[model samples]
Target: MGLTSTASASSEPYGHYYDEYSTVVDVTDVGADATGNEPITPVLEELRDDDTLLVFPEGRYYMDEQFRFTGFENFGVVGENATLVPANYYDFAGPQYRLFRLGVSYSPGDRIRFEGFDVDQTAPDTGIRTIEAYAAERLEVRDVTIHGQHDSGTWGPGMFNVTDPDGTGLVDQFRAPDGGAWINDTPTAGDRWRGPIGIVANQNEGTLEFRHCWLGAFPDNGLYAANGNGKIIVHGGLYRNSNGANVRVGGNGSEIRWPTVEVDSTRPEDRSQRGIRIENGRNITIHGAAVTITEPEPTSHAISVMNTCESARIENTRLELQGEDVNHGIVLSPDCGEATIADTTIAHETAGGYPFWIQDSDRTDRILAEHVTITGAAGDAGGFRDGIRCERNNCRFNYVDIEQPGRSGVNRNAIVNTANELTVYESNLRASQHPYIDIGANALVRDSALESSSGREAVCLYASSTGPAFKKNRLAQGIRDLGATDVTTWANTYE
Candidate 1:
């Protein structure tokens, strides 16, 4: 009872709205074990009430069953210096999945906050979800750390959602650094490729923000909040080594800002480790991201813009990739809509891949890349790799610099475009291989410097190409026109 007086919402993660509750009950004072000897699930059921705060004192609390509640006015579980020991897979009660189902999707709670619980799932085959909450109005989950490799094939650490469209939620500093393995590696799941995700909010319908959350490599994904029809904001997080995609989000008005995604390792069953995947969303933005993949899988990419995405904006992002595998920087799918990449740089020294791979998309789906820098080939490419491979039509690059050094052979180039209505304006394109700039039909290369390091042709118009225009450009080893018709060149220094 003495420890309950020192509890205050001022030191909480996002606790400006918590009111002063009149009743505060200690779990140990109400027939609960503090020595980690007995399960406290029954006592928690009895202690559940409205407009009250249940504070766990300094001790290890063991719970084999879940404690669920919903549709409450004001209820909070505060555990400042406490550790929750969950039972293993076979010994856990009920569904053997989650430990706390605070508010389900149907009977959502109001103004719920669960804070300061350090979960100890260190036993063999011991892993459970610490919280699965769905608050209708205000939800705040903070300072929850799960110290174990979630190998039990259950749900991951946390799952939160604000049920109402007008509600808001915040999950701050929830660190689950020791990620999980595949479901085939665990004992509970049978023959599954992937396991649980780190923090899931797929059913969210309101505004939810994840701030400074650190997630290690999980087998399934890092932050799987991609399908919810709400505003999901990830502000300042370090999401590393997760398969599929580290931080995958898609919703209306969603944003991933100041995120650091590192893929330095891979599991045996890991297929790909994508940095950020945006799908099934509109008006999405990824800003100020540092995506570094030192160890990449065969299909791994830094950022993937799926075809279901309506529009996206990637600005002020930096990508550094180094590996002996085929990994790309930013991949735009074929059916993707309008996209914008601005103030971004990609340093790809991988085995083979493009820095920017704009697939063969529809002509109406335009793309604009401005102030981007791409330089690589410090390591030899395994195959033909270009700095930018634009196969889609109606793409534009403005004030861009690409220097792919053809580390292995002369088959590589700076820009290889098979698309029509292409424009490269005010850019510096340099390649160590022959034909520094390879062009297709109906393209304009204006106010740009094109050169090759091996003293080869600066531009190569394909034989099948029809129209190409070069104006006011400094060319080094002049153009090699391979039967390209309607070739227009004016004010171009052919040196």
Candidate 2:
């Protein structure tokens, strides 16, 4: 609650910024000492920008060093049950550590504020960083509460680092829960303690808003931004147990709305966690996300719109994978450019792979999936496999709904196209051990409804498949073109 500047006339009638000239200063009236051994950084650098507010009333405020705040315009820092305890990284005072270093380095300031504190680094391993805001043009960190174990080593100290680029901000109701625990045991630091990253927005060119946050156990990323161009908005959150990606947006036009990600495998060295990773963005938008992967390993992917992402959109998402090595739910790699997934609901149980994975390497055009709904639960001799593994090319699946139940191994196809302009409109594929629409060259099955029942044909055209068109399809088994030349089965009705 701070932002009022309009009282010039050398304002200073009585303490606490008399009437908005700002100067509250109450670190025990400049003597500083709240039980945890003195040293309040010279009374907060003599009230840093001099228009200060710095009021830490309540308890424990023992800083061994590093609280530097350079060039402030309308600065404010209010704490009420105050607690900023860090003094054990070899007894503090080390090469540029941080507990609060606001502005300086391409300096440019205006209204910086940090409210209601609680940065308790769990005593000792202080690798620093619990609020580092540079070049602020309006940064307001609200209701903060970060506790212990940021791991300590390669720059790990869980919480906020906002790098401004004509900034516009609001990191509201933040709460970091035991983020990234890697007690530095040097041996070439292989996992690097998962690189403590939980709320990092660099190169922000106006528009950085993260509201209602509660990030816990960030192993690498739990809300990150890179190579900015501006716009990073993660509204509403509860990201937990991330070993890699739990919300990573590479700026250009970012957004991750209504998030509720919870991945479980209990830190098995962070077996490749992924919830929402949109790299190389350009109109990226993930709406109503609810990704839940419980006890699964083998490179988790619950939504990854890869590099060179352009015109992306995942609507009404709800991806759930519980156990049995969950892999992909939605992944479009290899020069991904044009993508669109609507009304999604991908559910897995004993899954061992694809629900939707369009990867082929430099051959992506328009991949549009409409009203998607893929459900699997196989495993125990023939794990739940493919659902939609297109190799990317003019892809389109409207009204899609794929269900894999029980037995189906050795590449159990439910809809696997090798890419060459494919479209399965009004789809509803059901497989149990193979073909349900595994095509190759220029395929199109309009008004579809293919079911494999128990394998062996429901449309399997390989062997250099060509211009295949089966209109009005409703096959229950039968349509094999191994040596295809130009297959066409119109008005199909095979039972």
The lDDT of each candidate is 0.87, 0.72
TM-score for candidate 2, residues paired by index? 0.42
Best by lDDT: 1
lDDT of 2 by residue, 261-380 (tens): 888756756767888888776888889899888765667788888867776888998998777664777888878788899998998764478878888855656889999888866453
**34: Cα error in model 1, Å:** 2.1
Q: How much is the lDDT of residue 474 in candidate 1? A: 93
In model 1, the Cα lDDT at residue 215 comes to: 95
Query: What's the TM-score of each model vs. the native?
Result: 0.95, 0.42
For model 2, the local distance difference test gives 0.72
lDDT of 1 by residue, 114-200 (tens): 888899988888888889999999998888999989999988888999999999999999989999878988896684557889999
